[model samples]
Structure formats: structure tokens, C-alpha cells
Target: MYAFKKSLSMGFDQAVEHVVEELKKEGFGVLTDIDVAATMKAKLNVEGRPYRILGACNPPLAHRGLGLDPDLGILMPCNVVVREEEDGSIAVVFMNVATVTGLSSAEGMKELGEDAAAKLQKVHDAL
Candidate 1:
């Protein structure tokens, strides 16, 4: 699958905090955070579920990837999503790093991807 997902037994706000902390522990820093629900409400006057998209990056890993392939910027920061389900549960989802960076033909990029994926898996396992 393209994503690694897990349900968090906590409120939306709490889940977001926990996910961020876990990511940080895994050497990732949140570069961007988009509040999808609020954005949709403001821009289109439409209501949506509580959803957030976090663009996370490990500078060291990202640097390595760039050195291998400058074009790696296309997948620079990995995306982690936190959303509240209709059942009142929250779910955390992160993209599969190995699968994403696998698109690159650059050597050693896959190893970097594997390292990243391992860290992210740790983050998920922590939850």
C-alpha cells in the first residue's frame, strides 16, 4: 500500500500532538501543516472532517537524497496526515517513503528511502 495507517485512540487535537512528537523522535521536523477542514470551510464555505496534512522532513536524510538526485525535491518532505473519523476516532497516516522515492533511478536513493521508511515505521509503532 502507498500508506501506513493506524487508528489513534484519542481526540483529534491530542492525536495531532502525539503524531508530531513521534515524528520528531524519529528525526523529522514539521515543515508545513495544512488544516484541510478549516481551509475548505474558509475557501469554499463547505464543511469537512477534521483533517491535517503535515509535511515532515529529516534534514540529514533530505540532504543525502538531494546529493544523490537533485530532482528528489519533488518528494522532498514526506507527508503525514491526521484526521478524525466519523466514528469519533482519529487516524494517522504516512506515505510509504521507499515506494515514493523508488521512482528515482538514482543509486543509493532507495537505501535512503529504506532508512526513512524504518524511522517512520518506528513512529507508527510508537503510537
Candidate 2:
């Protein structure tokens, strides 16, 4: 699959809360929240399913990556998402942190990304 998925028994709000809590434990802080459902409705006048994009970041890791490669800001703030399935289940997912790091081609970025990926995986696993 192109994405990582974790199903949760909790409702949408509760699932999001759990994700936030878990992310914090992993040293990630949410920097942005994009409510795709609401944005699409307001911008395009079209209706769609529920979806959200959360921009997450670990300041120390980000700083290290930036110090190694000055242009790494393009990949800063990892993304996490939460959405409702058709069957009323909630699914939480995130970008593979290691994958983004690999895109940098910087010497130390791979290891940094791998460590971030491991933490993100734990967040998903907790859900």
C-alpha cells in the first residue's frame, strides 16, 4: 500500500486525541492542522469524505537535519492524517519519516530520518 494505516475503536475526535498524545511522547509536536473536509467544502463548493493533515515536527531532529543540509526545509514538519472509513471506523496514518529523509541525500539525514520513522511507527502502533 502507498500509505500506513492504523484502525482505532475510538470515534474521530478521540482517535485524533490519541494520535496527538502519542506523537508528543515521541518528541513530535503538531505544527499545523488542515481540515481537508472543511476546506474542500468552503473552497470548491464540493462535498467529500472526511480527511485531515497534521504537520508534525521534532525540533531537535529538525535542527540537526537543517544543520546538515541547509535546504531541507522543504521536507520539514512531517505529516500525519486521520480520517473516517466508510464502515464508521477511524484510520490514522502518516508519511514514512525515513522516506522523506532519504530524499535529502545528505549523509546524516538517513539516520535521523530512520530514528524519526521509528518513533512515528510507535505512534501508529499505539493506535
- Give a tens-digit lDDT track for model 1, residues 1-127: 7789999889899999999999999899999999999999999999999999999999999999999999999886899999999998998999999999999999998999999999999999999
Residue 123 of model 1: what lDDT?
97
* Local distance difference test, each candidate: 0.94, 0.86
lDDT of 2 by residue, 42-63 (tens): 9999887778888999999889
Question: Of the candidates shown, which would achieve the greatest lDDT relative to the real structure?
Answer: 1
Q: After superposing candidate 2 on the true structure, give the runs of residues whose Cα lies further than 4 Å from its correct spot.
A: none
lDDT score, candidate 2: 0.86
Judge candidate 2 at residue 5 and give its lDDT.
75
How many backbone clashes are present in model 1?
0
Best by TM-score: 1
RMSD (CA, Å), each prediction: 0.6, 1.4
Clashing pairs in 2: none
How many steric overlaps does candidate 2 have? 0
